[model samples]
Target: MRPIAILSVLAGLSALTSPAASAQDRPPRPPAFASPEVTAEKKVSFRIHAPKAEKVQLSSSDLPDAGRGLDMTKSDEGVWEATVGPVVPGAYRYSFNVDGLAVIDPRNPATSEANNNTFSLVYVPGSETSDAKDVPHGAVAEVVYPSQTLQRPRRMHVYTPPGYEKGEGRFPVFYLLHGATDSDASWSTIGRAGFILDNLIAAGKARPMIVVMPAGHTGPFRFGGAGGVSFETQMAQFEQDFVKDLKPYIETNYRVIADREHRAIAGLSMGGAQTLNVAFGHLDEYGAVGVFSSGVFGITGGPNGGAPDTRWEDAHKSTLDDAELKKGLRLVWFGCGKDDFLLKTSQATVEMLKRHQIDVVSRDTVGGHTWLNWRDYLVEFAPLLFQGK
Candidate 1:
């Protein structure tokens, strides 16, 4: 090397080793590891390096006293730490509340999304149905189609079963729906629909099929809120889009069996109600209906905490009484948690249907209004679909 170049290189090396460079230029090396250290027992240890924050708390769907928040203590180095749970084996969402500000765990990359917010995800493996298993995986696609009814383009998440890209035959379609605050993306992400279906199909518990998760929130919806594009109005608009645009687009674009006997409709929470309205509105199009933790709005009775509204039943009296038309349906399934706020809603709906002589299967499990029950419902319900009985 030339003497000038050698001197310049030496000067740079000297600067890098200088005290000033070590103090200001080189950043503090990151910790050996980061937040969300999961133990074998499923207890999770979480940490955040925040020196300025006076308070930090852990908030998770599965944590004990979640509504009350789990306190996180600070260390000498200003890092906040907390450990919680033998967290149940499933996917969960968690966030750190730093002095009232909600923040996703920076150390965790896996995330679950909702219509209005996002949360960090952690998987507590060992679940038979919901966990990642040694099975053939399916493909989840996000595609958009023009909504002729709404005069706009809309998006949806479609899960084609394993080998669909290479397969040569048509498959049955399950129109899966999400909750009021969830977009079309919820099923494949937080709900883990793809993995659950893959596990089910691989284990011979379910037939391979297409699962379509559409955007159910056509407009704003807040439970117990008065006026301004109520959920009922949004449901009507969604029904129109589903029937006129979304359904036909899927049938044309994908390999779907275009018959009522090969189609099923189901959803959770807001989506469950949508399932009822859309499927019942066109009973000739769907062979099966699955309701998870939901009932007709305002028509809820018992523990739903209000005077039971029978106006909906009174309005649909003729249809409910038409047992002949509904007989064409192969299955009418309903599931709710024992502690779910909508337990009464599910019960009243099932009782009303039974009164009309409709054959309905009701399942009561242990859980509240959450995905724990929804995922379980899907695993239990998917096997019954497209069974040529």
Candidate 2:
């Protein structure tokens, strides 16, 4: 063969033997780790590649029947794996504990709100109520406003229903509140309030309205400390801030019907207590009130504290007068989970309301004090607002 022909052959051999060419010839790499894989059967398989870790465990916000806080086994390749549920269709927050250190799944990008402590979020789409469908979605905006009562700046998450921007007509408003330790963003993020409202409104199950989720913490009020402010004083400040500052800001900014008949207030846990405290007194401001997974628990202090003074009930009794409440209030709903520790408080409050001859809608939903129950409460409560007005 000629020298040129030999050189061309050598070049071809080198091209074939190159690392890039050899890579193509080799077997395809295994599929990258997909943590929290929801299977067809509704089971979820969680995986994490932690080779050096001695032990890793999985903790999830799933229901008890769905196998929460299960131990994961390590594979030969150093991947920790566990499968849980046949879980019911809904969104869940989960995290991995690597040898006592709680961490989020590195492979899962979906996450809950940072205010709720930022956990890996997974949604098993099934029901139209909780799932995001091909319907017109609402817009959520994080708004900052000055709190004159608290004498500081604060943030809130506002949700305007579909067609809010183009429409000239003013809509009803739902002032929603979050639980303790959760910020204003909790409702739209972890509770999925935006999607829930969108689905309900698209299906005509609920009326389109603006939702205002405000930060429940008005000022720093520590529990059981020398310089700590009393719960009553803190609540009074919050009420002043909410009614004076927040309400005026929202009414001035948003195109909402600013009347008692068109306004509603609802909350979960700590916010629930605040709801009862604030709305029960001001029946002229809110036509509907919803308290979920909480009652007069924190207001009077939890079980550790002594029984709430009779003056507490007396004050609400004075404000929630039977004739006034009947004349102005459209709905006064209270709900708690069967497994929730606050069940007794809710039941007692319901009895008290009934004794005052004020009609109350009491719901005993399934599950504990989790976001599942809060979302369900919102679904049930939103339709009741601004209805028959």
lDDT of each: 0.87, 0.83
Clashing pairs in 1: none
Clashing pairs in 2: none
lDDT of 2 by residue, 187-287 (tens): 88778899999999999989999999988865444555235556567667778889889999999999999999999999998889889878877777888
Give the best candidate by lDDT: 1
TM-score of each: 0.90, 0.85
- In model 1, the Cα lDDT at residue 318 comes to 78
TM-score of 1: 0.90
Candidate 1's C-alpha runs over 4 A off are 1-30, 220-229, 301-307
